[model samples]
Target: MGNGGAKFKFLSFSGKFRVLHLTWLAFFVSFLVWFNHAPLLLVIQEQLALNDQQVKTLLILNVALTIPARILVGMLVDSYGPRLIYSILLLITGGLCFFFSLATSFEALALARFLLGFAGAGFVIGIRMISEWFPARQLGLAEGIYKGLGNIGSAMAAVSLPVLALWFGGDDGWRYATGITGIIAIVYAGIYYIGVRDTPAGSTYFKPNKSGGLEVTSKLDFVLYLLINIPMYGALALLAWKVEQLELISFNVLLGIWAALVLLYLFQCRKIYSVNTDVFQGAVNRLQRYKFKQVMILSLAYAATFGSELAVVSMLPMFFKTTFAVPVALAGVLGACFAAVDMASCPSGGWISDRFGRKRSLAVLLAGAALGFALLSTITSEWPIAIAVAAMMGSSFFLGSAAGCVFAMVPLIRRSLTGQIAGIVGAYGNIGAVMFLTVFSFVETSTFFMVIGATIAVAAAAAMLLDEPADTMIEVLPDGTVQSVAMH
Candidate 1:
């Protein structure tokens, strides 16, 4: 827990610590509102008379818009600063929660959930704000604390929302429960706006030179950037296909969605070109150059780590119940241990990255995650349940740690591009979930675990190619003054 030269204080309410507290709280409220619907799905379905297919569609729609929303929000965070963007996001998404609560029809619920996915994008906002406040040496721990604690919002919603609903008592209890979270978000939006600044006094907040797409230093990187965007669009198309499989949409409608995706891809490519036209002209200075492969490798590693976490969390309870013959309630509690470990494991991973070398820490953690999953694949009916649970927890620790390590390196790559970098990496996490869950649909639990293990192993090898971030990065201030920002 090195805090550059300053003593690290967890309870302090001044300096960077205050900003960290406020920012993570903002993120916490966003996630709380984002997932408030999940635990109440049963009540929602019953009250709205939703069929099984409609319920599943609501689930899919909840995460559907997050991928693009993160990218769009990241660009805005970089352009306008996190303070304003975060406040507004919380304000608007909070209102959407109210709309979701009041929905009297299936279509209204679907639309509200889809729009509420934008709340997931709030994670990217704090990455930039924290990076601006903390020095490179302490960034991993700061970010780990921010994300690790903030992430608990989902777990909190799962635990508390049901209780709150019960306490409210009645058919509309779930609605009141959901609406309370929205009220909290709306209130917090105001607190966050008045409580925090984007950076410390006398520090500069750097903005990207171009707006529409990520800036690339080389023509090769320019091409790589375009190629990397294909999977994001593909993931959205996959969601549409899944909806169609549920007979929620017509085949013709699915084709229309795919066609629109292709067009959006082309439009994004044009934006990428516009942002990096300087690369084509050979005008980017050598010192100013960074390898886009860093972004690519981090994205792949994140997809494997966080992606598997999302997929596993959704299915682990069912796997436990069926494979081990555990009671439903017990299986769910046991399964939640996977996500519950994030509080400690995420910060430990970031602390390890800070104490050791970033590349080595990430590669080893990813490799460990692969091995952990491989061990998980060996679970069977005859095996002791305690051992199985231990294996799952062990695997969860590695997966969470690897995720922390991935973001630990994100802000270091390019200061001005941190938001976009975090956005792309964060979006890949959702893409990975979509891909792995799709695989699970066609395979057994053992096979699903094996696939994730194998994918992470490949990412571990790729992690070897990542260049260590430099000791200092150069950024241009709005005053046309070149400044050096410390990394370590």
Candidate 2:
């Protein structure tokens, strides 16, 4: 239904191409809004006279909801189509952005920041949308390009929003600058809703039969699935604990939230069993069911790669300033080089996976990442800045490439469940970020790097377990019509 031969082919002429462009544009806008506060946060801190703890609290609040949001959004995307779900998300997120911009008090800003976490759900929708449009042979590279390009939204915010605030040129300049990005988000919401479809006009858009849980194929897989779900909720509980430590909420409130999360877990498990009732009824052939192990492997892989990348990037500026003895401004540029590598390597990694073998490419990249982070931990201020830069580049290259490798396998697992699969995998990246950052908070910087390096080594070994995608996957569409899709 889509193009042939090239995984990185441009989708400019096809209707699917338009959908891809518009959908990614929508995602890009969501991200731009999502991170608009980051670069401008310093300005905000001065304006509001926030203590360092309050500033840290705001940063924590920004991503706190995203862990659960991704999981819930994945469920919603599979149950509803991307068109309606994505559009509403954009609208609501834009409103939150506007609210944040207009906030005059710390409390108002905090609430607005929390609501903005929903925008992080944007990634899940496009994973499913791109999977629907592209075939298996190209899914890895296609999804990689979509994710890589859209992810640049954070970089865009870092580079542009600060300048925008300066150009606006007043005490209130930041507000106007952020508000403009919000307006762009609102406008794009309408554009995407009208411009995109879940699939081609004649192509069937498959949905899971049950609304609340992931469908599993076996008792063992179901148990594994439940185990995988734990980290998702545990990540949420971790965030609640963070809020409590920051005194943002009371201990009792945190406990109540934790209890509610437990109940939610039970309800979700019930749904998993209900939807996967067929698993116990019939003995399905191996090829007929997706491997739960694959999901686990990719989850760990992303936790190490994208997860570590997120953690490193968060602490990068400070790492560079302290380790290399550079000025704050200079250190920021050096830090960016680490992230800038993603611009090229991320897409390249996907292309490599599509052309080379998926597992081989991932294994090779993860090995490089393990080595890169290990080298990073060995650096000292006495070393040349060039040497440090080289090390950071090495780390970023593998991280970006490994991200490409992880997603290359995401869509291949379950065609109809691509959103949920990508969601869970994506959530792991966020979890990695939180876990790695928390470790960084307690340990020396060198130890933090070494710990992440060790984590990547274990993940690299797991990469060996990933099987290259098979030739075809059979999906029963909504009308109970069977279809076989090609895999590379």
Candidate 3:
């Protein structure tokens, strides 16, 4: 009970569900702040006198740090626990948003944007918190609702923030509008810290076997782990290079960034070795061993699935404006449809995963997504608007379903290391987005969709290779006591 980390017993369904509502709302609020700039950037750009390259730089910086931030925050959540980490993250992001609002120049705005990327990492914390409260059977639906509903904030921001900027009026109105969002973030962080508990009563919380490293069962796993990490850091390096191309970061800073990336990769490799040392010693027992190939496959699947969705959502509105020759506002509204249905379909994906088989449902979802995106690539200016809209929505439906399917397997992968696993997988999703978007910067719209379609097909193939979930996964409680948790 000391330090306000109290363990309370869950006596009522109302209490547990209330926790779910509050936790998801916190996530919702974080996302709202995270994406508040996207819709209002047009206004900010004109007001600040920023050119196209500068604006693109801001966008790149906005997501540049998220890849590593997710991994670092994942470790912090697993070590210090989510209750404290999530609250602090909210507060820090709020402060950064406030800084972003007051920026007077492109450089200051870019710095704030890069720092603000950390908000995207907040999703990893809730994965652990939600897993603690809900049983395995319901975890998918719970996580789906949490992520799917929370994701709506971006769409909502796109719809409302423009109008909010107008309402404030005058030259500096955009700043005030963004400031209000920051204030909401600060207020909610305090509320969450006071209101939430990390775990339900009469339950043992699981922690990773070691701190500061991801445990692997074999030497090959250690090597595969290091190989998989390259892209995550590389994504950041790519962002830095993009910024340099836009003149956001100077040439010297770019070289420094490249050097830092090499060092970080080396450090990561050392950690992988540290975590897998027991496996090399032949001290890992059968109960403690898990297939690392599963982790690698899921990471690749997530990169293509969720990553493509992130990249597509960022560019689809612009594509519609150019291809369909529509008003920017209308194009944005049409693009919003891609994410809008997720609020419903994600929960449906989770419910379906729970009722049917986990692996089978995920495979079906991935297959559907690949086909949907491929169909979407066939759309052109010659097509009717209705048909195009339907195609895009279909693509998002399958993508959202696949997102639900991925997290449906996240908690089931390794019960104790759920946060770290979710973090790595989530980082791959951002890495996918960055890599795909970087590709989009060079390719045409039709080609962009085709590239994404091909990526999804690859992920679908990986989904076919994934092992099915079983009845249970093993975890060790704090007292060094092992327990078997249901995977249904």
Please name the candidate that would achieve the greatest TM-score relative to the true structure: 1
Clashing pairs in 3: none
Overall local distance difference test of candidate 3? 0.82
| Clashing residue pairs found in predicted model 2 | none
Model number with the top lDDT: 1
**Model 1 residue 219 lDDT?**
88
TM-score, predicted candidate 1 vs. hidden true structure? 0.98
Alpha-carbon error at 272 in model 1, in Å? 1.3
lDDT per model vs. reference: 0.91, 0.84, 0.82
lDDT of 1 by residue, 1-488 (tens): 11346566778988789999999999899999999999999999899899999999998998999999989999999999999999999999999989998999999999999999999999999999988888777888788888899999999999999999999999999999999998999999999999998877777779987899898999889989999999999999999999999998999999999999999899989888888888878668777788899999999999999999999999999989999999999999999999998778888888888879889999999999999999999899999999999999999999999899988899999999899999999999999999999999999888999999999999999999999889988886667677777776
Ranking, lDDT, top scorer first: 1, 2, 3
Worst 10 residues of 2 by lDDT: 1-10
Task: Kindly indicate the candidate among 1 and 2 with the higher lDDT.
Answer: 1
| Alpha-carbon shift of residue 451 in model 1 (angstroms) | 0.4
- Candidate 1: what lDDT? 0.91
lDDT of 1 at 349: 86
